[model samples]
Target: MANIFTSSIGKKLIMSISGLFLILFLLVHLLANSAYLFGPEAFDLIIVIMGSPVVVAMVPVLAAGFAVHIAYALILNRMNMKARGAQRYEITHKGEADSWASKNMLILGLIVLGFLVFHLSHFWAKMQLPEFTGGHAENVNDLMHLTFGNPYIFVCYIVWFVALWFHLTHGFWSALQTIGMNNTKWISRLKGLSYIYATIVCGGFIVIAVTAFLRANGYIG
Candidate 1:
């Protein structure tokens, strides 16, 4: 077991599995957030369902999966950097050995992480944490509007989502590649699917942010 974890292939396998776990979580989370499109009542119903005892009990599990994913990524990245011995991040040419997204996963991941902090501050801090601490929970639909109402915050979210798009475009395919799904035919298919999936997944969040921003500014009915 120890040797398996310490081996490069094993570490990568861990990365692939944990990454896929997070991907599944993101899809489910995006679906839940989509309730806002139906209005405050529908969105609040989602919040109620998700906040139920059974779902709340799974929060720790989800957090642990995310933590494991992050830990493995950092460890693998550090090891790769050490092996490259300071040539780790130099992409000086358009035809560099790897795709731009492949070379900059760490930077993209960090940006996403930072934006998550910003996002959680606006929503989780205002809603979940308060409710957990015996304070009133804010309506999630209203929270979306409040968070995106500011043009600056709205722009920030769009930037963050773009970064997330790049991250997932690489990550989705890489995760599959790492797990032995890398035949030539499947390779092309995975790349195409990655873009489609990433766009759909990230697009969902972008639409919400854009809609909220426009609606708050009275740009639509």
Candidate 2:
């Protein structure tokens, strides 16, 4: 176990498992967030379920998965850089066959992480923390309305969703590849699967964000 943690293959395997876990969490989160499009009542009901003791207990597990994914990425990136040394700057791709998101995963991941912090501060902290601490807010919907009612937050959410889309595009397939699913037969299929999964997850969030913005702006009934 200790050797696995210290080996390159072990780290990749850990990252792959954590990535899959986070992806599953993203699916659940997207479903919860999409309830906002159904109106305030539906959204509040979803929030209540999310804040339930069972769901609340999984929050730390999800957070740990995210932390592990990011830490492994940073470590791998550093190792790659050191191995390349001065040649890193001189290397040029030959009209790369890989997707853009795959090549720039680290950059996109960082952007997604940055926006996640902003999101937690604006929404999660206000909604979940208060309840956990035995204090109370009037209602979750009130908090949602107040937060999304702001034009700046609405724009920030849009940007965050975009970054998330890019991150998921590469991550979905890469996770599978890392787990020994890279045979030629499955490679193309996995690429298509990645796009489909990324679209569903990112599209779900975009729908919620855009719809909330429109509703808050009086553009939607």
Candidate 3:
């Protein structure tokens, strides 16, 4: 069991499992945010549910998952760099087609992590933090409107999602491959699935952001 954390393959396995877990987390998050499309009442209900005892209880678990994923990622990157010795510009690729995203996953992940902190400050802090602290939580729909209403914020979010798309496109399939899904037959299929999944998830967020902006500006009701 100790080897699971110390061995190279075990570390990769842990990272892959945690990565997949976070992918599922993103799907659930997207679905929850989708309620915003139905207007204030529906979104408010989601906020209530999210702040409920059960969901609130899961917060630490979710945070731990993110911590494990990020920690292992940094650890693996450091290990690779140490193994590379003097090679500074060359990046080792797994037995898949060399793509820009595959090589830059760490960079993309940092960007996503940065924006994720920014995102939590705007939404989670305002909506959930107050509830936890015995203060009044803001109206979910109004807050969404206010956050997305800014044209600059809207654009920045779009860019963040683009970085996320690239990260997902590579990370998704690579994680699967690390977990024994790699085979001659499944390789191409997994890659295709990665692209489709990334598109739908990121595209959904883009749609929500755009619609929120339009509604906030009174261009749509």
Candidate 4:
């Protein structure tokens, strides 16, 4: 069982499972945020529900999942580099075998993580962190509006989402492939599925952010 963490295949399996968890969280997050477009009341209800006792109890578990995913990613990358030795950069078909995203996954992950730090500083720090520390809660919608209204922040977020898109485009199918879906019969199908799923997840967030920026800037009503 310990080998599961130590072995290359096991590390990947763990990474894949954890990735799926984060992806599921993204879908739920978007669903809750979508309320902002239609009704502020609906969005507020989501904020309230997420802060309810039951949901609050689950936060630590969710955070641990994220920690495990990130830790294992770094560990696996180090292991791969060690296994390849100096020949790592000499592979002729590296792109063919892995594609651009697979080669760049670590770099993409770092960018996404950095943006997440910026994101939490803007949103979670103002809302959830305050409430957790017994401070008054701010209006979530208003906070979102204020952040997106800033031209600099709005552009930064758009760029962040583009980075996220590439990360997901590679991550979606890679997870499935790690979990025994990599037979030749399903390879092409999985790659196609990756793009479709990545598009929906990333595109949903991008559209919502863009709309918020426009609304905040008075370009839209």
Q: Rate the local accuracy (lDDT) of all candidates.
A: 0.81, 0.77, 0.87, 0.81
Question: What would the TM-scores of all predictions be?
Answer: 0.91, 0.89, 0.94, 0.92
Cα lDDT for residue 195, model 1?
92
lDDT of 1: 0.81
| lDDT of model 2, residue 204 | 83
Off by over 4 Å in 3: 85-97
Top model number, lDDT = 3
Tens-digit lDDT string for candidate 2 (50-77): 8789998988888899999999988866
Backbone clashes (count) for model 3: 0
Off by over 4 Å in 1: 85-96
Which of the two candidates, 1 or 3, achieves a greater TM-score against the reference?
A: 3
The digit string of per-residue lDDT tens for model 1 on 77-173 reads 8877777644442231222246778888889999998888888788878777775799987877777777899988888889999999999988888
Model 1 root-mean-square deviation: 3.2
- What lDDT, from 0 to 1, does candidate 2 have? 0.77
Query: Model 3, range 118-218, lDDT digits (tens) per residue?
Result: 99999888878887798877788888789899999999999999999999998899889888987768878898999999999999999999999999899
